[model samples]
Target: MQKIAFQNELTISTVQQRNGANNTKKDVRKIQSWLTLFAMTNAGAATATGIDGDFGKATEQAVKNFQKAKGIPQNGIVDQATFDLLAAPMRAAFLSTITGTDLRGLVVSAARQHVLNRPFELVISQQPNSGPWVRAYMDGNEGREWLWCMGFVQTILDQAASVVGKDFKQLMPLTYSCDVVGTTGLQTGVLFRYNQIRLNPALMKPGDIFLLQKTPNDWVHAGLITHIGDDFIETIEGNTNDGGSNNGNAVLSRVRNFRKSKLDVFSIEGLV
Candidate 1:
């Protein structure tokens, strides 16, 4: 597969992270971050002590445990091969090139690839919304204050749009707030409210953004619409888990019923 050129603040170099190796703080931190995210999804796997920029005994043991779980050599050393495995999920998602001329097709492909990669947020040192994935999508900002649902949506949109020389920031500002995106969509005549979309289902299309309406004027969360049916829409959302809460962790694929959920549509009809 051709690797798309995507660079983020957390991009790790090819340097190996192993005990007694002269590991830079940047490299060690990336290793710990990968280990942390890996443990969050896998059950009972050993997690790094914390992303403290250290490859201490605990981090080594965690690497060994991760190696064991992966059925690789339990050498407790992060060699080039081991680092490749550790960073596969993130590298695969960011590097994937979705080849197409259709903008909506590109958007759906980008969003689906992210869900397939499983960008799960990590709560390191009791801090919520702080992780490698969160930083990547949120433009190097991560913490409890940075709710990344809209950030994730924008990142995917930006990725898809960039391929065709279209900028999503023009449709809506590059913002992390759902209110900004929702209000911008409304002001620009691109937003279809729940009531309007319920009547005109054709207005909603794959790759259009879905805003979870809090009130008639307020949207609490945002996601990418991947499929639209008679009664439901399949969504790939960020900062949400299996329960579908706006504040939950991870990017998840969810089936949301239009009849039950107050989801407004932000159409990207003319953007392409």
Candidate 2:
């Protein structure tokens, strides 16, 4: 699939500035491209009418059509609310009655499907259910490449939850931000943050998550705990390569130092 071409990446500050009536001609074009790609597949007249950075009648109408479909206000402007609404992509098939009685086991079972080092070509640009690994994860959501770690974890939770007829959101909050996951887990009485979990080889369990930290309050990477030992912990993490760059391109099952790495741990009991 052809990527949405742009000179630079969209940042939170830029996104905030581009919303509503504050949008410039350039902002409008970006919005037009994103909306058309998200809701209408970027072809035909499905909001695909604008690329000239002009919020003309066609752009306005396209925004309105997107708003109408999303059940948001039918204002022909790109507001923050509208931008937020466009973030969610479609979900793939929903499987009911998971055969695994164990929640953590189910998560591991579902996670085993995607291989490490798999490329983005198979993951991006496809119909809801058609794409293999990436499409299956993140509820078949798409966009903003390189943020697949959270999606990978979320997909495991979803697949495991589906087996037991439980809503995935109810089991665990899904988010791209590790801090958000940590915060939500604490608020919901479902997760123990880094210092609280009391991690040791004996204390850790399978299917629990480890949040590798960037700061005490900010977490940068996360992965499932598959095994624990005296000196190291085994993990299945997404977006990590053999060199252990947290921002790498693929999922990997790697071993980490037991005590030296800065990290946070969460129990699976809260999710189960």
Candidate 3:
């Protein structure tokens, strides 16, 4: 495996700036191109097809080809598990190839260790899945409460603070909103609004939180700061199903480079 250098350690302000720059159509296309290149590289496919991050026919066809080769369903869609599998080996190789320091590995390892150290909480209502551990904190039951991914992020933040003997409250006012086409609000902790704190994935340090914006609803998903390599990120998140049944419970999993339409990658309070 080829080792790659991790990104620089980033602050909340810096992350916000990077995310803000992504608002333009050109930037979005650039990000999509990057993602397409990333996916093609791992899927053992050809990037010359010019998928270019559009998620159009070319990308879909590439996904189908990869799926057929992998013997998973030829769904033509890249779900979480498939995304993880495709990127994992390359990421591992990249990390190993990087020299000078093992900062990326250390960060990822720390996040995994943090999840293992905590007791699993039941995701009763919002997330009605059964798993070995609690992935995130859920608000209400299936029909009632909404599943707030940010809550889970907050939970992990709280746990990290406890380990360091710091007050989680001090980490407040973190950016917890998303920037979608028309929606905007500070009330929702999951979405990133304009002027929210953002971080650069390449500059993220250990204990920094990465916020992801879910499509359509524009909800946010949180992951603890871990490893940041040239091509991927390693994070430990709870309540992530990875295409499995919700009953699987929470556990530490490595997340490849995040590929979302509009996301905010920044720190809130804990890491400074």
For model 3, residues 18-106, the per-residue Cα lDDT tens digits are 22442333322322333343443355654223412245566556556666667789766554465544434323422332221333333
Determine which window of 10 residues in candidate 3 has minimal summed lDDT.
Answer: 1-10
Task: Rate residue 152 of model 2 by lDDT.
Answer: 71
Best by lDDT: 1
By the lDDT metric, which is better: model 1 or model 2?
Answer: 1
Ranked by TM-score, top first: 1, 2, 3
- Give the local distance difference test score of model 2: 0.58
The per-model lDDT (C-alpha) reads 0.83, 0.58, 0.40
**Which candidate number maximizes TM-score?**
1
TM-score of candidate 1 to 2 decimals:
0.88
What local lDDT does model 1 show for residue 89?
87
Give candidate 2's TM-score. 0.55
Q: What does candidate 2 score in Cα RMSD to the true structure?
A: 12.7
